[model samples]
Target: MQIPLSQPDITQKEIDAVTEVMTSGTLSIGSRILEFEQKVAAICQRRYAVGVSSGTAGLHAAMVAAGIGPGDEVITTPFSFVASANCILYVGAKPVFVDINTKTLNIDTTLVEAAITPRTKAIVAVEAFGHPGGMVEIEQIARRNELILIEDCCEGFGGFAGDRPIGSFGRAGVFGFYPNKQITTGEGGMIVTDDDRFADVCRALRNQGREGMAWLAHQRLGYNYRLSEIQAAIGSVQCDRLEEILENRRRVAQMYMTRLLDNRFLILPTITDDVHMSWFVFVVRLNDLFGPTERDEIIKGLRASGVGSNNYFPPIHLQPYIAGPYGFKEGDFPRCEFVAGRTLALPFYGKMTELQVDHVVAVLNEQLEKVQMVRKPRI
Candidate 1:
């Protein structure tokens, strides 16, 4: 069986919702978008939500709403999807790379305070792999520094940091609805915030700077980042079944954990006591003995065996675009680079079966042994 890396858990309910929207003449900026935004806001425990074309768009809008512009600096981890850092760049601001906590794979809050400079305007904290680790600490640090906090909840839609929902800790938080996420709208996102003014700004930003249904009047420069009615209609249905979707994902995650927890060569995802995770991808790290080369070989072997696998992330700082311009070297963020080198993402989805999970584990174990034997030749 060829187990794919990720799949959307779509049902007839979502199809019916999409069909209803298609039948309706009004497609964009309609009631479906409004309803979807409301549902997302409620889920994040925020007063408002602005639907956008993608999570990247939501983050860019949040950065713009926060007045982050030229000469400003936004601190974020290097061990995340590039969008987290790219949003800072979209506004002509610099993104200061930080290392991640080895355990949670999120930004190391302990080091955040030290990264703050006078030019530091905001902290773009990403809930990496849907784990809300160190978010509370990051919030406290941001408050102390008087910096804006933008929570990248792109992978953390249904998670919590202690008693608070994932989006509530920041001035603005964004959720992505990519196919691989816990819930999907094909390609859409939501920006959530309690700040009324910020919400208005994001809403306008997503709709070509038109304020309050003014279609042609442009107040400021903006992008066409609006989420479509069809996407929102599907999203609304997904939101209605959010609990069921999250529970299904959690169940699949547990299955992986139960099967792989005893493996000596791998380090599984860590969930802190105070935080509730919304599992996005099941990523495991090869032990310190395994380097990027070995990890890549293992991934290759897994794929060769019909088990889907991939390196979850490569350090964003080391990417050619960022590294060359910013003068970032390999050792700039050791912890992040270390973790990025060995991290492996396995096939994960709400509907993934136990047999599939077992097959993936078996393939992974076989690959690990092969790499190990090659590294240490028989004497």
Candidate 2:
């Protein structure tokens, strides 16, 4: 009955791909990396893709390659992993925190325009927890502002809005190949873009500013963020099965919704009608009825019952680094900060079975019942 919150769906294909790369001896900047790049680009319908060490590297490269540097401000949501904001600081650029929509939990397109200024260079919008983040509206904002946009597709690869994938909407969309992503590359990332200039910049930045191949001449100073052939090979193999993985994840999401339908003490994650939602995580927000301290108690109960659950992220601005020196505080992004303390991610992955899913939900309901009983006196 024990269920993990997230698990990589690795199989024999990943093994075979890695073995082939190991035997080739051309591990770094080899054919495998090239192959994986092509596949990743094709998935997003982008003309080019450059593989890198991780999604963080992909975001950093995107920001730098787009000519964003000291004093430039990148508008982004505070309701995501720290890496999203940290990438902005890597280029010596400032990350301007913006609010997120309460329902979709993605950066609010309505709030983005007000945040942009003359120094505003790009927008790094995360497709938080696999929802596509309403790319259509976001793109319109980008077009109007003439801002470079980097879709942080780390949690949202394989997700589309009205046929265009999330990453393809922006100048450069980045994907995470971390173990739990829709497809894993054992800690790798890809930058997909239709703009040839951006693509060249990404490729150069990933390999220490080399225009072509590792041994080639350097044009600008860059870091060694290239992905190994072994990782790319694994990514390419995983890429082939992406559709199947998305289907499985969708099925799991539906099961969770059905099971938790009548639970008034918790708010289910919301998905917009525009999204295909490649279900990366199922976030459940604790309702006020659970009382002030009940969310923490429910997590403990879920763990004791062996159902994996945890919060997705804390608000980026509220992090100590940004809060102390950058002058960010609780009331800054009220919705994001509020959600951060209440939302919990439940067990979700492509490989989970119906029985496993049911067990997780059954545990959630039982825990809620316990909380209600304990808090009845207060009510």
Candidate 3:
């Protein structure tokens, strides 16, 4: 039974692509990287794409390219992967936290404008759990305030906000290809943008600040964030199969929904009509009657029963690194904290079978019922 939380779908095609690159003489900054970047850019409907070593590198490069430095403020949601906020810190800028929408789990657009200030420089909007909700309003807010919009599309590759792709909404969008993501490059990321100068800056930032592939010339201080040829080759093949992968993920998502939709004790993911969701980790939340203690117990019970589960995110603002320095405490972002407390990411992947899904659901229900018996007053 031991269903793992998440897995990557890799085929023989991807294996062959990696093998070809490994045999090729050029390993770094080669044609494979160019092909991968081109495929990503076209998919995002952007004119340029820069391949980087990781999603964190891509976001940091975007912040630098946008001229976000010390004393500047970047607004973002606390209910996201820590990198979404950590990227702001990398550029020596302050990350101004905003609460997220309870249902969508993305940053609440209503609170975004209020968070903007004279020093506000950018908005790092995340597609939480791969749902591109409220991005249109966030884009409008950024535009009206003249703020740089860096879409953190790390969890959202094939998603769309209305008719437009997820990466098309921001000034520069970043995608990650970790092992657990929709696609994997072992470890890599891509920055997509229509702005020529921004694209050029990111390209330089990933290659030791070299301008136009000069071997020894360094234009500015930069980190070594270049993606290797082998990773790029794998990414290129993954890009070719992106649509099929997404469809498979969607199918699994539907299976989970069909099985769990009637559970009164759990709250399933909310997918709005306007956005086409790219399924990442399928997370479910315990109802209001259940607190963090109950949620933890359920997760532990599921794990003990050979079903993998985890809290999708702990609030970024409450993390010691951010909280100690910024003086952030509990209740700063009530909505985010509330949702984060109960959220549980279950086993999810494109190749997951119906029997595995059934096992996970059964374990979850058994755990929920056990928790309910112990806390009868809340029920």
lDDT of 3: 0.93
Residue ranges of candidate 2 with Cα displaced over 4 Å:
213-216
lDDT of 3 by residue, 1-379 (tens): 7899988999999999988877888888789999999999999899999999999999999999999999999999999999999999998999999999998999999889888899999999999998998999999888999999999999999888889898898799999999999988999999999999999999888888888656899998888999999999999999999999999999999999999999999899987788798898999999999999999999999999988899989999999999999999999999999999999999999999999999899899899999999999756
Between candidates 2 and 3, the TM-score winner: 3
Model 2 scores worst on lDDT over the 10 consecutive residues at 287-296
Reference-based TM-score, model 2: 0.96
Provide the lDDT at 209 for model 3: 89
Q: In terms of lDDT, which candidate is strongest?
A: 3
Rank list by lDDT: 3, 1, 2
The TM-scores of all predictions, comma-separated, are 0.98, 0.96, 0.99
TM-score for candidate 3, residues paired by index: 0.99
lDDT of 2 by residue, 282-354 (tens): 8899886653368778888899888888877878897888899899887898888777878888888987898
TM-score of 1: 0.98
lDDT string, candidate 1, 185-223, tens digits = 999999999999999888888878888666799898888
